[model samples]
Target: MKKQIFGFKCAFKGIIRTINSESHMRFHIVAGIYVMLFSMFYSFSPTQYAVLVLLITSVMALETVNTCVEDLCGLVADRYEPLVKFAKDAAAGAVLTVALGAAVIACIFFLDFNVINTIFTFFAENLLYLIFLLISAVISAFFVVLGPVGIKEKFIKLKNRHLTKG
Candidate 1:
Protein backbone atom coordinates (compact mmCIF):
# COMPACT_ATOMS: atom_id res chain seq x y z
CA MET A 1 0.00 0.00 0.00
CA LYS A 2 2.74 2.41 0.95
CA LYS A 3 4.63 1.59 -2.25
CA GLN A 4 1.54 2.28 -4.35
CA ILE A 5 0.96 5.54 -2.57
CA PHE A 6 4.56 6.54 -3.21
CA GLY A 7 4.17 5.71 -6.86
CA PHE A 8 1.09 7.90 -7.11
CA LYS A 9 2.88 10.72 -5.32
CA CYS A 10 5.81 10.50 -7.70
CA ALA A 11 3.48 10.52 -10.66
CA PHE A 12 1.83 13.70 -9.42
CA LYS A 13 5.22 15.26 -8.85
CA GLY A 14 6.30 14.43 -12.38
CA ILE A 15 3.11 16.00 -13.74
CA ILE A 16 3.72 19.14 -11.72
CA ARG A 17 7.30 19.36 -12.92
CA THR A 18 6.23 18.90 -16.50
CA ILE A 19 3.61 21.62 -16.20
CA ASN A 20 6.22 23.97 -14.82
CA SER A 21 8.82 23.20 -17.45
CA GLU A 22 6.81 22.45 -20.59
CA SER A 23 4.78 25.21 -22.23
CA HIS A 24 3.01 22.77 -24.52
CA MET A 25 1.82 20.76 -21.54
CA ARG A 26 0.47 23.92 -20.01
CA PHE A 27 -1.43 24.70 -23.22
CA HIS A 28 -3.01 21.26 -23.25
CA ILE A 29 -4.03 21.61 -19.60
CA VAL A 30 -5.65 24.98 -20.25
CA ALA A 31 -7.37 23.70 -23.35
CA GLY A 32 -8.62 20.65 -21.46
CA ILE A 33 -10.12 22.87 -18.81
CA TYR A 34 -11.86 24.94 -21.44
CA VAL A 35 -13.16 21.78 -23.05
CA MET A 36 -14.57 20.60 -19.75
CA LEU A 37 -16.19 23.95 -19.14
CA PHE A 38 -17.75 24.01 -22.56
CA SER A 39 -18.95 20.47 -22.03
CA MET A 40 -20.98 21.65 -19.09
CA PHE A 41 -23.31 23.41 -21.51
CA TYR A 42 -24.32 20.04 -22.90
CA SER A 43 -25.52 16.88 -21.27
CA PHE A 44 -23.42 13.85 -22.10
CA SER A 45 -24.07 10.20 -21.49
CA PRO A 46 -21.77 8.62 -18.95
CA THR A 47 -20.07 6.64 -21.68
CA GLN A 48 -19.52 9.78 -23.68
CA TYR A 49 -18.05 11.50 -20.66
CA ALA A 50 -15.76 8.56 -20.19
CA VAL A 51 -14.63 8.85 -23.78
CA LEU A 52 -13.90 12.55 -23.26
CA VAL A 53 -11.89 11.73 -20.19
CA LEU A 54 -9.93 9.15 -22.09
CA LEU A 55 -9.22 11.57 -24.88
CA ILE A 56 -8.01 14.21 -22.44
CA THR A 57 -5.79 11.72 -20.68
CA SER A 58 -4.41 10.44 -23.94
CA VAL A 59 -3.38 13.96 -24.97
CA MET A 60 -1.76 14.59 -21.61
CA ALA A 61 0.06 11.28 -21.68
CA LEU A 62 1.39 11.90 -25.16
CA GLU A 63 2.51 15.41 -24.18
CA THR A 64 4.33 14.01 -21.18
CA VAL A 65 5.94 11.30 -23.29
CA ASN A 66 6.99 13.93 -25.81
CA THR A 67 8.54 15.98 -23.06
CA CYS A 68 10.45 12.96 -21.82
CA VAL A 69 11.69 12.18 -25.30
CA GLU A 70 12.83 15.73 -25.91
CA ASP A 71 14.59 15.86 -22.56
CA LEU A 72 16.30 12.55 -23.16
CA CYS A 73 17.35 13.63 -26.58
CA GLY A 74 18.73 16.85 -25.16
CA LEU A 75 20.79 14.93 -22.64
CA VAL A 76 22.03 12.45 -25.20
CA ALA A 77 23.04 15.08 -27.71
CA ASP A 78 25.26 17.92 -26.58
CA ARG A 79 24.72 19.60 -29.95
CA TYR A 80 22.53 19.11 -32.96
CA GLU A 81 22.39 15.58 -34.38
CA PRO A 82 19.99 14.37 -37.04
CA LEU A 83 18.95 11.24 -35.12
CA VAL A 84 18.30 13.22 -31.94
CA LYS A 85 16.28 15.70 -33.95
CA PHE A 86 14.35 12.85 -35.49
CA ALA A 87 13.55 11.36 -32.09
CA LYS A 88 12.41 14.71 -30.73
CA ASP A 89 10.33 15.44 -33.83
CA ALA A 90 8.68 12.03 -33.70
CA ALA A 91 7.65 12.48 -30.09
CA ALA A 92 6.25 15.96 -30.81
CA GLY A 93 4.48 14.61 -33.84
CA ALA A 94 2.80 11.94 -31.77
CA VAL A 95 1.51 14.60 -29.39
CA LEU A 96 0.22 16.68 -32.27
CA THR A 97 -1.56 13.71 -33.78
CA VAL A 98 -3.28 12.86 -30.52
CA ALA A 99 -4.25 16.44 -29.86
CA LEU A 100 -5.67 16.87 -33.34
CA GLY A 101 -7.58 13.63 -32.99
CA ALA A 102 -9.09 14.88 -29.76
CA ALA A 103 -10.07 18.11 -31.47
CA VAL A 104 -11.86 16.10 -34.11
CA ILE A 105 -13.72 14.23 -31.39
CA ALA A 106 -14.65 17.53 -29.82
CA CYS A 107 -16.01 18.82 -33.10
CA ILE A 108 -18.13 15.72 -33.55
CA PHE A 109 -19.63 16.20 -30.10
CA PHE A 110 -19.89 19.98 -30.01
CA LEU A 111 -20.68 21.11 -33.55
CA ASP A 112 -24.45 21.23 -33.32
CA PHE A 113 -26.02 24.57 -34.22
CA ASN A 114 -28.63 24.22 -31.50
CA VAL A 115 -25.96 23.54 -28.91
CA ILE A 116 -23.96 26.52 -30.10
CA ASN A 117 -27.05 28.68 -29.89
CA THR A 118 -27.79 27.36 -26.43
CA ILE A 119 -24.27 28.20 -25.30
CA PHE A 120 -24.63 31.71 -26.65
CA THR A 121 -27.99 32.11 -24.97
CA PHE A 122 -26.56 30.88 -21.70
CA PHE A 123 -23.83 33.49 -21.74
CA ALA A 124 -26.26 36.17 -22.87
CA GLU A 125 -28.57 35.31 -19.98
CA ASN A 126 -25.85 35.16 -17.40
CA LEU A 127 -23.72 38.23 -17.93
CA LEU A 128 -21.99 37.81 -14.57
CA TYR A 129 -20.93 34.34 -15.54
CA LEU A 130 -19.75 35.72 -18.83
CA ILE A 131 -17.55 38.16 -16.94
CA PHE A 132 -16.20 35.32 -14.85
CA LEU A 133 -15.59 33.34 -18.00
CA LEU A 134 -13.66 36.19 -19.48
CA ILE A 135 -11.55 36.48 -16.37
CA SER A 136 -10.87 32.78 -16.43
CA ALA A 137 -9.88 33.03 -20.07
CA VAL A 138 -7.34 35.73 -19.28
CA ILE A 139 -5.93 33.66 -16.44
CA SER A 140 -5.82 30.57 -18.60
CA ALA A 141 -4.03 32.52 -21.29
CA PHE A 142 -1.43 33.60 -18.75
CA PHE A 143 -1.11 30.09 -17.42
CA VAL A 144 -0.49 28.63 -20.86
CA VAL A 145 1.78 31.41 -22.09
CA LEU A 146 3.74 32.33 -18.95
CA GLY A 147 3.35 29.16 -16.91
CA PRO A 148 2.93 28.95 -13.13
CA VAL A 149 6.62 29.48 -12.41
CA GLY A 150 6.76 32.55 -14.62
CA ILE A 151 3.59 33.93 -13.01
CA LYS A 152 5.07 33.36 -9.54
CA GLU A 153 8.28 35.11 -10.49
CA LYS A 154 6.32 38.04 -11.90
CA PHE A 155 4.25 38.35 -8.73
CA ILE A 156 7.36 38.18 -6.56
CA LYS A 157 9.00 40.88 -8.59
CA LEU A 158 5.93 43.06 -8.31
CA LYS A 159 5.80 42.57 -4.56
CA ASN A 160 9.45 43.47 -4.19
CA ARG A 161 9.06 46.53 -6.32
CA HIS A 162 6.09 47.69 -4.25
CA LEU A 163 8.05 47.12 -1.04
CA THR A 164 10.91 49.24 -2.34
CA LYS A 165 8.50 51.98 -3.38
CA GLY A 166 6.76 52.07 0.00
Candidate 2:
Protein backbone atom coordinates (compact mmCIF):
# COMPACT_ATOMS: atom_id res chain seq x y z
CA MET A 1 0.00 0.00 0.00
CA LYS A 2 2.84 2.37 0.84
CA LYS A 3 4.53 1.58 -2.45
CA GLN A 4 1.38 2.34 -4.40
CA ILE A 5 0.94 5.59 -2.56
CA PHE A 6 4.51 6.54 -3.28
CA GLY A 7 4.00 5.80 -6.94
CA PHE A 8 0.97 8.01 -7.05
CA LYS A 9 2.93 10.79 -5.37
CA CYS A 10 5.69 10.49 -7.93
CA ALA A 11 3.19 10.65 -10.77
CA PHE A 12 1.70 13.84 -9.38
CA LYS A 13 5.17 15.28 -8.91
CA GLY A 14 5.94 14.62 -12.56
CA ILE A 15 2.76 16.42 -13.59
CA ILE A 16 3.65 19.41 -11.45
CA ARG A 17 7.20 19.39 -12.77
CA THR A 18 5.94 19.42 -16.33
CA ILE A 19 3.66 22.36 -15.60
CA ASN A 20 6.52 24.24 -13.94
CA SER A 21 9.00 23.53 -16.72
CA GLU A 22 6.85 23.97 -19.82
CA SER A 23 5.63 27.40 -20.95
CA HIS A 24 3.08 25.85 -23.30
CA MET A 25 1.74 23.85 -20.37
CA ARG A 26 1.35 27.11 -18.47
CA PHE A 27 -0.58 28.56 -21.41
CA HIS A 28 -2.85 25.52 -21.45
CA ILE A 29 -3.49 25.90 -17.75
CA VAL A 30 -4.35 29.59 -18.07
CA ALA A 31 -6.63 28.85 -21.01
CA GLY A 32 -8.36 26.10 -19.06
CA ILE A 33 -9.00 28.44 -16.14
CA TYR A 34 -10.44 31.05 -18.43
CA VAL A 35 -12.64 28.46 -20.10
CA MET A 36 -14.07 27.26 -16.83
CA LEU A 37 -14.60 30.79 -15.49
CA PHE A 38 -16.15 32.06 -18.70
CA SER A 39 -18.43 29.06 -18.85
CA MET A 40 -19.93 30.21 -15.58
CA PHE A 41 -21.22 33.37 -17.29
CA TYR A 42 -22.94 31.38 -19.99
CA SER A 43 -25.81 29.00 -19.35
CA PHE A 44 -23.98 25.90 -20.42
CA SER A 45 -25.75 22.64 -19.94
CA PRO A 46 -24.08 20.01 -17.77
CA THR A 47 -23.44 18.02 -20.93
CA GLN A 48 -21.56 20.93 -22.45
CA TYR A 49 -19.46 21.31 -19.33
CA ALA A 50 -18.59 17.63 -19.36
CA VAL A 51 -17.53 17.78 -22.98
CA LEU A 52 -15.50 20.90 -22.41
CA VAL A 53 -13.77 19.38 -19.44
CA LEU A 54 -12.87 16.28 -21.41
CA LEU A 55 -11.49 18.29 -24.28
CA ILE A 56 -9.46 20.49 -21.94
CA THR A 57 -7.98 17.52 -20.16
CA SER A 58 -7.27 15.76 -23.43
CA VAL A 59 -5.16 18.66 -24.64
CA MET A 60 -3.34 19.01 -21.33
CA ALA A 61 -2.65 15.31 -20.97
CA LEU A 62 -1.37 15.03 -24.52
CA GLU A 63 0.92 17.96 -23.90
CA THR A 64 2.32 16.33 -20.79
CA VAL A 65 2.82 13.07 -22.63
CA ASN A 66 4.59 14.93 -25.40
CA THR A 67 6.95 16.48 -22.91
CA CYS A 68 7.70 13.10 -21.42
CA VAL A 69 8.37 11.62 -24.81
CA GLU A 70 10.68 14.45 -25.79
CA ASP A 71 12.59 14.16 -22.54
CA LEU A 72 12.94 10.41 -22.96
CA CYS A 73 14.20 10.83 -26.49
CA GLY A 74 16.72 13.40 -25.39
CA LEU A 75 17.99 11.13 -22.64
CA VAL A 76 18.55 8.18 -24.97
CA ALA A 77 20.10 10.17 -27.80
CA ASP A 78 22.61 12.71 -26.56
CA ARG A 79 23.70 13.64 -30.06
CA TYR A 80 21.52 14.73 -32.93
CA GLU A 81 19.90 11.71 -34.51
CA PRO A 82 17.32 11.61 -37.23
CA LEU A 83 15.31 9.01 -35.35
CA VAL A 84 15.21 11.21 -32.25
CA LYS A 85 14.20 14.19 -34.35
CA PHE A 86 11.40 12.21 -35.90
CA ALA A 87 10.21 11.01 -32.52
CA LYS A 88 10.18 14.51 -31.09
CA ASP A 89 8.43 15.93 -34.12
CA ALA A 90 5.87 13.18 -33.94
CA ALA A 91 5.12 13.96 -30.31
CA ALA A 92 4.73 17.63 -31.13
CA GLY A 93 2.49 16.77 -34.04
CA ALA A 94 0.28 14.75 -31.74
CA VAL A 95 -0.14 17.79 -29.51
CA LEU A 96 -0.91 20.01 -32.49
CA THR A 97 -3.52 17.57 -33.75
CA VAL A 98 -5.25 17.43 -30.39
CA ALA A 99 -5.11 21.20 -29.96
CA LEU A 100 -6.69 21.77 -33.34
CA GLY A 101 -9.44 19.30 -32.55
CA ALA A 102 -10.03 20.94 -29.19
CA ALA A 103 -10.34 24.31 -30.87
CA VAL A 104 -13.02 23.00 -33.19
CA ILE A 105 -14.81 21.39 -30.28
CA ALA A 106 -14.69 24.66 -28.35
CA CYS A 107 -16.07 26.57 -31.28
CA ILE A 108 -18.95 24.16 -31.58
CA PHE A 109 -19.65 24.06 -27.85
CA PHE A 110 -18.73 27.52 -26.56
CA LEU A 111 -18.64 30.15 -29.29
CA ASP A 112 -21.33 31.85 -31.31
CA PHE A 113 -21.66 35.04 -33.29
CA ASN A 114 -23.67 36.39 -30.38
CA VAL A 115 -20.75 35.82 -28.01
CA ILE A 116 -18.99 38.82 -29.55
CA ASN A 117 -22.01 40.97 -28.93
CA THR A 118 -22.25 39.64 -25.40
CA ILE A 119 -18.59 40.45 -24.75
CA PHE A 120 -18.98 43.96 -26.10
CA THR A 121 -22.13 44.52 -24.06
CA PHE A 122 -20.50 43.31 -20.86
CA PHE A 123 -17.29 45.32 -21.43
CA ALA A 124 -19.27 48.41 -22.42
CA GLU A 125 -20.94 48.45 -19.01
CA ASN A 126 -18.40 46.74 -16.75
CA LEU A 127 -15.29 48.77 -17.35
CA LEU A 128 -13.66 47.69 -14.12
CA TYR A 129 -14.02 44.00 -14.84
CA LEU A 130 -12.65 44.56 -18.33
CA ILE A 131 -9.61 46.29 -16.94
CA PHE A 132 -9.15 43.52 -14.42
CA LEU A 133 -9.40 40.94 -17.14
CA LEU A 134 -6.79 42.74 -19.24
CA ILE A 135 -4.41 42.91 -16.31
CA SER A 136 -4.99 39.28 -15.51
CA ALA A 137 -4.27 38.34 -19.12
CA VAL A 138 -1.00 40.26 -19.07
CA ILE A 139 0.09 38.49 -15.91
CA SER A 140 -0.90 35.16 -17.35
CA ALA A 141 1.14 35.97 -20.46
CA PHE A 142 4.17 36.62 -18.29
CA PHE A 143 3.74 33.32 -16.54
CA VAL A 144 3.37 31.55 -19.85
CA VAL A 145 6.51 33.13 -21.22
CA LEU A 146 8.73 32.80 -18.14
CA GLY A 147 7.14 29.74 -16.49
CA PRO A 148 6.60 29.34 -12.76
CA VAL A 149 9.76 27.35 -12.19
CA GLY A 150 11.90 29.85 -14.07
CA ILE A 151 10.47 32.72 -12.03
CA LYS A 152 11.04 30.85 -8.77
CA GLU A 153 14.60 29.92 -9.70
CA LYS A 154 15.42 33.50 -10.61
CA PHE A 155 13.93 34.77 -7.37
CA ILE A 156 15.92 32.25 -5.34
CA LYS A 157 19.16 33.20 -7.10
CA LEU A 158 18.50 36.90 -6.48
CA LYS A 159 17.72 36.26 -2.83
CA ASN A 160 20.86 34.22 -2.34
CA ARG A 161 22.96 36.90 -4.02
CA HIS A 162 21.47 39.55 -1.74
CA LEU A 163 22.10 37.41 1.33
CA THR A 164 25.76 36.91 0.32
CA LYS A 165 26.20 40.67 -0.18
CA GLY A 166 24.60 41.40 3.14
Winning candidate number (lDDT): 1
lDDT of 2 by residue, 105-155 (tens): 877767776875787789789999899999999989879988887778888
Q: lDDT by residue for model 1 over 1-166, one digit each (tens)?
A: 9999999999999899899999889988888888888998788889878888899989999999888898899888999899999999999999999899999999998898998999999999999999999999999889988899999999999999999999
Q: What is the lDDT of candidate 1?
A: 0.91
Candidate 2, overall lDDT?
0.88
Predicted model with the maximum TM-score: 1
Off by over 4 Å in 1: none
lDDT of each: 0.91, 0.88
Q: Per-prediction TM-score, please?
A: 0.96, 0.87
Residue-level error in angstroms, candidate 2, position 103: 0.5
